[model samples]
Target: MKDLFDEIDTHQPERQPIGEGAVLLRGYALQLGKDLLPSLHDIGAAAPFRHMVTPGGFEMSVAMTNCGQAGWITDRAGYRYDSHDPVSGKLWPPMPDAFLDLATGAAREAGYPEFSPDACLINRYEPGARLSLHQDKNERDFANPIVSVSLGLPATFQFGGLKRTDPVRKFALRHGDVVVWGGPSRLCYHGVPTLKHGSHPQLGSVRFNLTFRKAL
Candidate 1:
């Protein structure tokens, strides 16, 4: 059987509008792939990725870690941003310059020029891991945009309207694709479906998502 990842279109970078304020920048982060991966490794070595439990006591399928000033966390206490890693009991690793540059550049390309993210939630998805449709509302400001970069295996991205029941549009997100949404689409619901089994040259069988947000 042919691998699913082999079918993904390795296209050139281009700006694609998915909503009023949301854009999928195809192949936007391809140039940064080399630098970003190594930085991700260092950050993971520092904080490590672990499955977090939701306030409802359900364990999340995705393994997560973070960099920057704050990290988004969920537990019995509820979903919120914390400055320290819950497991390490220390401040999250500093956001690398390459991460900030890529996020800022992508946000600008998506028409959010002033976006300066302070928190980066890194989610690692293995086969069968999925995320439920949800809104990112834990941040202090909705004026800032959300910048998400995809790496490794390809996955389906679910972007919906403001309501959970609203119609959702799925997009095939491959390595180096970046999605930025804010303004009218800042609070839109979004998620990932269960990832299919696949392997990548760099990341093996895992996929990584770097979500940048302004959480001060």
Candidate 2:
């Protein structure tokens, strides 16, 4: 598998917001609301969301699905990548151009310079769902930044440093917000705070996230 950077490198333009090594691009998807949900539904139809059990035998609070060449998985067997979806024995869903474009743009904005992603992990957070602080360390490469986009109800994003005990900067993310962090901050700890019970007129009570990565 070729890095998405191979195809998206020369297209990076200085159009996104940059901060230190991270970048925050806001309202980048508001114009595509009509298309985004349906596209996500198509992806779900292909790779359906399911709650995964962690190595510790605890069910992960978040519901997840995937699109692209690989999907992140955790279980008693530990974290790893597989081309076939365990639930369906079929190839995982394909990442749409919209997802790819968004990820590439956000990553470049985050100073990755040349960003290309092969896996897009789509996570769904309903009321009460929360992910504990953790580092993204299972990917085949750390040179790529993780591009995360939010949709639906607002969520509190916790961005911490390289250490698990590091203090975190919490940000309130509403629908259509995109956050990209890489470089020295790529392995920094991060997670969503407990989701508040609420309903978004557009997406009901569910919050959706698209996390772009380069996994093979």
Candidate 3:
């Protein structure tokens, strides 16, 4: 209950960069947080998180699901990347080699080396969930690099820029924090803001992000 790398080796997480091929490796999954929270609860017991709907139909308060070889989805014909699991159509839960070696070792420690992610998604905030800035551009290659990975509670990311009114920079993600971004910040405009009310002794009030893309 208390050894998530003991306060991350008693301070010294700093990697933080921010743009141009981004960075933020802080705590880098805190020693793999006991193997990435039981392989993300066994890939959510085989893809079972929901809240999707949004091609203007509007419904997504952040509950999602996924693994590898594709995942991120949405409805009304939009937001792609799907290898099935349009709700148990199956085939969407297999990427857990500790989530492909913690997203290929956090995209080679934020420098993007052999990062072979296929897609991971898996968000799941709670206290008034919210993710707005945008610009992931539905994968298929933005030159790769988008590792994300915080685990429970604590949010506030919003790294904006490259348009949409630019100038953002919130940060604060906690639990294992990873964030990678990509060359030219890979289309920048990040998000995740409205999640407050806490409690996380191991994911209590909830907040489990993950992201990791390379979606083909």
Candidate 4:
């Protein structure tokens, strides 16, 4: 992949507050972008991305895979986290050091210094792929914040209130952007809208999101 950091201007990291306990760290992950992709590629090779089916039997638009101690999955049974990948029948690949560092650093910067994630959900979105608004309540603990890193193409992120029908605010997330939400906003409904058709010089037409959470 080409070095996108070189093409973009070097600037101080900017923090944009999204809610009472949520923030958007603009260009916060650029420092680690070059190393992240290679580690992600290795993890994907071990446990390939697959579109999972929801409990309602509908297939998801985004392809997903995971690293660390647990991997999230959904099916007729329901949504839950498992130590083993259902398809491979083996433990999910270990989370890379760089991934852990990025997650912890971002969380700390967002005011959650004790965040230690056990699961990192990797979501791949192609043109037109989207994620529906949902809460991250499947995890056992709600105290840990969610650290989501955006890579490749840009996307529109929808952040809503506690209830599903609550008002929502949209934010434009570009490559190397990270969002952290915890405390009272940990269970807030959030998702990505349909990805626009565009080619990112480094990552082609796909957008990859790495969401770190404490699943256990």
Q: Find the candidate with the highest TM-score and give its number.
A: 4
Write model 4 residue lDDT over 1-216, tens digit each, in one string: 456565554777799999988999998888654568889899999999999999999999999999999999998999999999999899999999999999999999999999999999999999999999999999998988999999999999999999999999999999999999999999999999899999998889999999999999
lDDT of 2 by residue, 123-203 (tens): 999999998899889997887788998988899988888899988888888787788888888898999989999987668
Task: Give the TM-score ranking, best first.
Answer: 4, 1, 2, 3
Best by lDDT: 4
Summarize candidate 1's per-residue lDDT along 1-216 as a digit string, tens digits.
Answer: 333233345575788999999999998887553468779999999999999999999999999999999999999999999999999899999999999999999998899899999999999999999999999999998999999999889999999999999999999998889999999999999999999999887678999999999999
Instruction: List residue ranges in candidate 3 displaced over 4 A.
Output: 1-8, 18-21, 31-35, 48-84, 87-135, 139-147, 150-177, 180-209, 212-216
**By TM-score, is 2 or 4 better?**
4
Pick out the ten consecutive residues of candidate 2 with the lowest summed lDDT.
3-12
lDDT (C-alpha, whole model) for all candidates: 0.92, 0.80, 0.83, 0.93
Number of colliding residue pairs in model 4: 0
The better candidate by TM-score, 3 or 4, is 4
Question: Which lDDT tens digits does candidate 3 get at residues 2-115?
Answer: 644455545656688888889887777776646677777888988888899998899988899988878889998998987988877888877877777878887887788877
- Assess candidate 4 and give its TM-score to the true structure: 0.97
Give the worst 10-residue stretch by lDDT in candidate 3.
3-12
